[model samples]
Target chain A: MPFVTFLDYAGVAVFAATGALAASRKELDIIGFLFLASVTGIGGGTFRDLILGIPVFWVINRDYVWICASVAVLVFLTAHRFESRYKLLLWLDAVGISAFSVMGAAKGLVVTGSVSVAIITGMLTATFGGILRDLLAGEPSVLLRPEIYVTATLIGAAVYTGADIAGLAPLLASILGFVAAFIVRGGALRFGWTFPAYKGRPGRHPDDIP
Target chain B: MPFVTFLDYAGVAVFAATGALAASRKELDIIGFLFLASVTGIGGGTFRDLILGIPVFWVINRDYVWICASVAVLVFLTAHRFESRYKLLLWLDAVGISAFSVMGAAKGLVVTGSVSVAIITGMLTATFGGILRDLLAGEPSVLLRPEIYVTATLIGAAVYTGADIAGLAPLLASILGFVAAFIVRGGALRFGWTFPAYKGRPGRHPDDIP
Candidate 1:
């Protein structure tokens, strides 16, 4: 449970950082940056919680709320020095994704007693927050990008599923899943890996072709 | 019932037009444009219905889905000439907002026995489609704008509530609500009326105060 709390905090912070960094780039004032960041950080998990008929985490736990907001403020204040080296932000985002995905999966399993649903929840927890942040920031969401974003989460879910099936301890399984996702995402960024796209080349428009 | 159905379709078409016009400005292809328009047209109703534990309108009727998509396609085929003209897009958006606000209130009242809840539902139904579209298209959502956007929907919801209490038929109540929202939003746009920021002057952070 303590470990789970750690992951939750880490996830919340990373999500906030992504939003804060993006907002800062837009020249938004500190209040605007924090507002955007807090929303982005908690957005995905809150969405999952809402759909699952649970109290929103930040609302129920003031710690989560304050942490998210504080992280955003900290990031904004320190961003000027960190801006030249942006890799730190990306790494933080990855760690956040991994942590949230693991926590989400575990929570889903605990709440629903269904592994499949839990896995889906884990994936959603990892992705939806960033998707919302990206959308609000007017960036093309990763869903449309040739990025392996969802794939990383899917693989993480699968790892978690496998651990569950093998009767591995839940905490261990979560850790394993998190590591898997983190590595996949980090390796992709480092090696310039990308998913394939249908680049609007002269493809046969079967719908248009009578 | 038949009249209600007519209004719903008209609302969806109008919202779809607004989405298509906005997405076209971003040079999104038909798929992206349609996706945006569909969300703009139905996102609020779907969310409202889902929260109310009722089946989403499009999922239950399918007619709603077809109307949104087909309108989007039709609009896309003619977008080049229209998207550049901001006034045209604004006009379409206003129509969509008005119709959606009315229908939202009408349906909410029909489904829920509480007038206050109905008002909230109406406001959500009128506003969320645009909130969603803005999120998707990476524009600042109208909800966040310093304008009387959502206030108009709230007033319209109130009028709808009054009409319902006054023994007006559902269709008449819906029409009156739509006209109220249309006139308010149209007047705001025409006169460039906007809400002033609530910020107190510089060097005075309310949060920072001892």
Candidate 2:
């Protein structure tokens, strides 16, 4: 349980860093960095807890907010030192996603005793934060992109849920899920892996065809 | 109480229509239209309930989902016939925001006896759905616009909260709030009222100055 808590904190910190990097790209002020970081760090878990009808984790404990705010401040002071902040953001986001996917599924299983819901919570926890970040930053959403981001989270969540259902040890199952997600997301980052984007055909609309 | 319930349903329907209009502009499929409409319709209330640690209203009732889905389908069928869909969308959005602002504040007051929380929840309920709609549709978010959108919601919420604190009747307070929000929003739609946007100053970076 302590290890899982550590993973959660690490995921939040890394996600906050990515949000701060995005704020920097937008030339936002310090308040903007703090807002984006806090939102991206907590958005996914908040969504999961809401769906599960549980008290929000951050509201019960304020440490998460402090962690996100601290990371935002650190990133604001030092982000300019990076040669390619975008590259750093991608790497950090991969780590955050892998960590959150396992932790979210574990929490869901404990709360709901349902495998399918656990898998979904895992996916939501891993991806919703980044979605909110992009929305607030006015950047393209990862959901709309061709990249293999969501697929990676889905695979991770499924593997974790399956392992848990098969009675694997908790830590082992978490490791398996984290590794699965990281491998897929890392591959996409390194090799530009992508699914084919939808293309509109020139044919008449279905409702329009007489 | 029944009137409040009616207001909630009407707000959801109007918000869903705006979301479907956005999906049509994006040339999305039927599934996409349904998804966007449902998200935009129930999103703000979901946020409110989650923060209040109450059961999500839609998950409990299910009628909200039906209303949103029905509105989406209806708009999808007849939207093309409108000569100025954008104008129609704006008017409907004004109505939706106004109703939601009052309802959100009232719910917040009932759940938590804190006036500040009530005002904040009201603002969230009124604006968050439209923000999500714009983000998903890849349109510039109303938050990024100079329009008096959030201001209208804030004012409406504050007025409602104040009236309730002054021992006004619930129905009367709600009407006052809704009318206040609608008048401001409607004015913005009819005549281009906007706050001045922030302008970046040309100066040396604060951290870089020696």
| Best of the candidates, DockQ | 2
Q: Give me the candidate number with maximum TM-score.
A: 2
For model 2, the superposed segments whose C-alpha errors exceed 4 Å read: A1-3, A6-10, A13-39, A50-53, A58-85, A112-120, A135-138, A141-210, B1-43, B46-84, B112-124, B131-210
- The per-model lDDT (C-alpha) reads 0.73, 0.84
The per-prediction CA RMSD against the true structure, in angstroms, equals 9.0, 7.6
Give lDDT tens digits, candidate 1, residues A1-210. Answer: 667778888888888888877665545555455556766788778777866877556544557657777887787667766533235645676777788778888778778878888889988988888887766655456565444667778778778777877899877887898899888887776775677756777667889887
Q: Which ten residues in a row have the lowest lDDT in candidate 1 chain B?
A: B198-207
For lDDT, the strongest prediction is: 2
CAPRI verdict (incorrect, acceptable, medium, high) for model 1: incorrect
Backbone clashes (count) for model 1: 1
**DockQ of the candidate models in sequence:** 0.06, 0.09
TM-score of chain B of 2: 0.92
Global Cα lDDT for candidate 1: 0.73
